[model samples]
Target: MARVALKGVRKDFGQTKVIHGVDLEVADGELVVIVGPSGCGKSTLLRMVAGLETVSAGEIAIDGRVVNQLEPKDRDIAMVFQNYALYPHMSVYDNMAYGLRNRGMAKDEIDRRVREAAKILELAALLERKPRQLSGGQRQRVAMGRAIVREPKAFLFDEPLSNLDAKLRVQMRVEIKKLQRQLGVTSLYVTHDQVEAMTLADRLVVMHAGIAEQIGTPLDLYARPASTFVGGFIGSPAMNFLPGHAENGTVEIGHGVSFALPGQAARGDVTVGIRPEHMTLNHGAGMATLPLKVDLLEPLGAETLVYGKLPDGLEVTARVHGETQVAIGSTLPFSVEPRHVHLFDKASGKRLP
Candidate 1:
């Protein structure tokens, strides 16, 4: 395993810049996930690290060695792509051994690596099966097995599980996490799904446009988002934003509700952010309360999601325990803890200090 570093990395297609000066470090044996909406350059960034794409500017280092001009095969990294680029005519065993064979390893050494990879992937029993005969998850494991056989300095995954069904995706997520830890290999994974990024990453890089908006542990990003884009993108049932003004140590949200600033003092127009899960039906006298008109209720067995609007017509969402009983069209009181409320500058959409 080795540390991966990107210093002011960038990519451009003619005059169009896709990756704009991203600097990041992945510790040896760390699994870092790059997540963002499509066209945010997450995939392009991963490809640059793999040496599959040219670095338009800046440096990419693996194990402290600059690899900007190395070929994909010479970079000592293996990439498992979204399409599971397997040989259709080859059996699982051959698929995993092809890379080693191409490197001119001894036949016995190739066989040994192939068998060990198959065992690690639980594909030993399916070694004779061709790509068409394997299930989606099994084929993805075969893709991973191919990477594992190389014993590369790092592993890169590009939406490797996107082809699976929802249930299979969840199962493979656990498998990938366990496999990465067991191998202790440095890894960089890219995905558009925030849920997958949250569940799998030791750390996350949230990208927007062509820039890395934030990079931190999942909980850190969730609790203290660096900007409004991160707060809205990292959490499910996205954080609710209310247009309001901050002045005189108080934030005046619509409906005449105001919250006292608990720490830093900022005055001017601001966007207030509160996660759905942080809003509750219970409130104390000091807390700010807002009246919500319930529009719909979605019960997911384990929890229920309430969709509603405030008196000022700002839409909001609240998550509650599954046992809570509520009806549509009813008025309910909702409150958020003072510390849970986030304020962002209205003009810049950046978190306020």
Candidate 2:
């Protein structure tokens, strides 16, 4: 329903700057997820858009209207928080209808909206039940129903599924995605869970230390990360970094361990990045091999994680088939393709050409 945009958005607490200048646009009916570790300013950035926090600088616009001076209620946005935030004494119907009632809406219209939302959320049967009588998933549905009835211009979600169990989290995640698509509301979601971010977002903003490290589709960040931090953060097992020197179209990771570069790289000290999944046990033509002294093994059904150290004492991990047999203290050769290797500037930690 509405386009939300932030231009040079920033935040400051006293003299400390917690959010650097961040600019983003959430297109109408698009879902943009902001993901990062804790203290990365993701939540703060969402709060600024919702008018829950003051914009120390920059501008926030909703539906082409500047709202830096507006209050949260005037922003025409609904927020779903991590905590359920339900009223224990009030039944589900009343909880969903409370906001409309306060706005002095006609009783009949309020009833219609509440019942419609309840039906969509599959909470019609639980409308009379109090929050205390509902399961965690049911309670979360009620919260979502309450927000849906508002018909706001945009929706803001702050780690909405964090408090649920693992299984419930997955279930709720699917439901949220479906509901958002059905409603077609522009949404900005903040979460520390990368899996959720990758699955739910149309686009993702990866933040770090109050700065947005990269903004792109999930697969784009995974395949062609803009920096070492992004290379290490977006993937499941995380990319491994090794100190190396690059010169003459080749990189020497350690003494007597080197690989030819697929393309030109910075001509001096560089960090070599390799994804665990990219390493294989088979020695193929044009593949470079590294001697790994196995230190630990984790068997994960379909795949096993081999944790070990290279001959130079640098730690590395490899994801291998579960059936592969190996033991501690044994040295196994792991091979990597030259094209799968990544290079970064050692001093700046930025990806190199």
Candidate 3:
């Protein structure tokens, strides 16, 4: 319902600075997810936008109006916390209607909004249940429904699905995506889970050490990371880093293994990054090949993960098809395409252009 913008946002506590000059904008009706590891200032940033935390510097605007001094209630935003924050004594219906009642809305209008939210969240029959009578997913839905009934200008979610089981988290993820799309509400979500962030976000803000490492669509960041940190953090199983010496058109690493650097001219000490999913057990003609001494194998039903070390004792991981058979302590050949290889500066850890 509103466009949210952050211009040079910075937060500090006494002498320590947590957020450092973050600039971001969320278009109206877009779902943007801010994802990072623990202690990365993601939740703190979200709290600042929700008016729960004061901004030490910089301006936060919602719907083209600066809300630097506005109270949480006056900001016209709804927040769904991680813990659900539901009352044990109130029924689901009363829980959803409590905010409206406090705002002096008519009883009939409160009922209409509450019922509409319940129907949308598939909680119509559970309206009479108390918080203790519901499951974790149900409680989460109640928390979301409470936020939806308010029809606020924007929604802020702080790791709302952290408490659910894996299956429930998957189910709730689909539900949340569908709900946000149906309502067309602008939302900003914070999560430490990279997979969850990749699945739910239209655009993702990857944060590190109180700074945004990269902000782009999930595919963009996955295909080409801006730095070594973003490259290692955004993917599952993480990207493998090999210290190599950059030559005129190639980087040599680990016991004479050299990969062709196409279209790059950075020649010096560099780090070569290759994703696990891109490593293939089958070697093709004219492809770069590395011999790996397999140390471990994890057969996940759909695919197998092979963990091994290169000739120079550098660790590497490869994802192979489910039917592939491999033995520990055996030497297996792995191939990688030249284009899938990523080059980064060894000194600064920044990706090479």
**Model 2 deviation from native, Cα RMSD in Å:** 1.3
Each candidate's number of clashing pairs is: 0, 0, 0
Q: Candidate 1 — which residues are off by over 4 angstroms?
A: none
Residue pairs whose backbone atoms clash in candidate 3: none
lDDT per residue (tens digit) for residues 53-164 in model 2: 9999999999999999999989999999899798889999999999888889999999999999999999999999999999989999999998999999999999999999
**lDDT value for model 1:** 0.94
Please give each candidate's TM-score: 0.99, 0.96, 0.98
Could you give me the TM-score of model 3 versus the true structure? 0.98
Ranking by lDDT: 1, 3, 2
lDDT of 1 by residue, 1-353 (tens): 89999999999999999999999999999999999999999999999999889999999999999999899999899999999999999999999999998899999999999899988889999999999999999999999999999999999999998999999999999999999999999999999999999999999999999899999999999999989999999999999999989988789997689987766588889999999999998887578887889999999999999999998788899998899998999988888888899999999999997
Better of 2 and 3 by lDDT: 3
Q: lDDT value for candidate 2?
A: 0.92
How does each model score on lDDT? 0.94, 0.92, 0.93
| Model 2 CA deviation exceeding 4 Å by range | none
Position 153, candidate 3: lDDT: 91
